[model samples]
Target: MTERQALVVRGGWEGHHPVEATDEFVPHLKEHGYTIRIEDSPAVYADGAYMETVDLIVQCVTMSTIERDELAGLIAAVENGTGLAGWHGGIADSYRSSSDYLHLIGGQFACHPGKAPAERKGEQADNFVPYRVEMLPAAAEHPITQGIGDFDLVTEQYWVLADDYVDVLATTTQAVREWDPWHRPVTSPAIWTRQWGRGRVFVCTPGHDMDVVRDRNVTTIIERGMLWASR
Candidate 1:
């Protein structure tokens, strides 16, 4: 049998440490006997034909622009049957100019008012508040989050615009801080999965830095998500 193939596309804003994030996970995929091809640019999306042959795509891109042709190619490839996975802005907040891309990913990054590094000077980071991730009761038994319970961490909590149809696996409650208003605590999706045609889409909102991405639970969840989504 042919070894499972995976494509890792990395680039865009350096603030999120896209390269580091990709580095941390590629080894796990290799351990599972995956043939990995790493792309350092978003231009790889333009190769519709090349994309179709792969089984999974791990994208790590921040805010960037994709040409019309490249965007179309990517769409066709994913819809045809390509598992897509990524954490934080690398996959979620990337290509803001293309609403179609957001629609494909099932969510878009709006704001991360948590603790951001000085590198992301453009982003407004107040206190990188400590918070807990609560697994949704309905999805607690799912493979990706099964046997996983609540955990606390201090990191940038992402406020994303997510689709209602997504199967949300975990969530975090917004804190009522002195700096911000919205006194009513809001529950936001921390990790979720969706189906696009024959493809599976997985999104995790936790990785604001390398440390968070390296967290054992975070890595386990993303690794499982990638394996579960592969064709």
Candidate 2:
């Protein structure tokens, strides 16, 4: 079989465990005949030639910054037919300062509200609320989400700000809990895909950590998404 090239660009906040998260899929990428090049920073994105040659990019950087040229190069690669796939804050919450990056991904991490004040213990884990990922009707036929039923997860349920460019596959709703100020439940796209130029972009909002990424449902969706998004 012919070999394909994949790039794993990871690094940012340690809380998301970028290394471990991406590691979970590296072996899978290899099994599928992909030669992988792993980078710890976005600097590699500045190399337009290398970026154009990459068939896929699995990014896991969260709450980080990207330089102007780096962001431009990354965008150009995707627009030129390089697939981009990532989950949780790694892709959705990454590059908060770069609006162009947000436009490329088609979604932004707004917040993940925690349990009620009375239930909190002054820890970040408070945001790990029980939630369900509801697959949309159309997703029943989408390759990335097909055969994946609605599932429950007790993790960071991201409230995303998404645009019309995305094709949402699955969604999660945040209820109006006692502590939450919203009057009604808010629904956010938990899994989505975007087509930019000749490239494909896939984002899954449930991968807050390794365990979450390892969830059977999440794993299947991510694996299929990576392949489906590839050029």
Candidate 3:
């Protein structure tokens, strides 16, 4: 078998704790026989030669500005068959200036309407909230979630606006509650998979913090998902 490699691009908005979180996840990939390379800046991604030698790219960057060439190289690498995978705002809300980047990934982070209560300040809304994630039939059979069951989490239940081309792996139904004024019933995808050229992409929206990702179910599911998404 050919050797496998993984490049983990971290370091963006410190609020998301990219360094800490990616540090915790690196061991899991290392144990899976992947040679992991960690970068604290986006410069590494701009280097075309560096980006081309990898089998997979695991991004943990959130709300940061990336240069035009750097962003283009990352997208081209993925479109040319380098697997890409990430979770939460890191991948979904990253590079707001780049429309092509969002197009390549198949989803964008919309506002978290459920947490927008007038009484609670900005701090409260971004804090952890309890919710349940429902596994879709298709995801239940997929390798990433095969043994995973419906689980409760206290993390941010992301309400993303997904593209139609994505195959939703799981969903979290955001229910209207007294604390939240919006009473519209809707289902938001928690996990999804999409194909870009010969590459595969898997995204999970449950990892708001390192503590949330430490959950056995979440860790296992993400580890499996990384392996499944890697080329």
Strongest candidate by lDDT: 2
lDDT of 2 at 175: 89
Give candidate 1's error at residue 56 in angstroms. Answer: 0.2
Candidate 3 lDDT tens digits, 66-91: 88888888877887788888888888
Residue-level lDDT of model 1, residues 2-81, one tens digit each, is 68989998889998898888988888899888999998886887887788888999999898788888888777877889
Write model 2 residue lDDT over 26-133, tens digit each, in one string: 998999989999999999999998998899999999988999999999999999999999999889999999889999999999999988888889887888999999
The better candidate by lDDT, 1 or 3, is 1
TM-score of each: 0.91, 0.98, 0.91
Among all candidates shown, the one with the greatest TM-score: 2
Q: Sort by lDDT, best first: what order?
A: 2, 1, 3
TM-score of the candidate numbered 3? 0.91
Residue 80 alpha-carbon offset, candidate 3, angstroms:
1.6
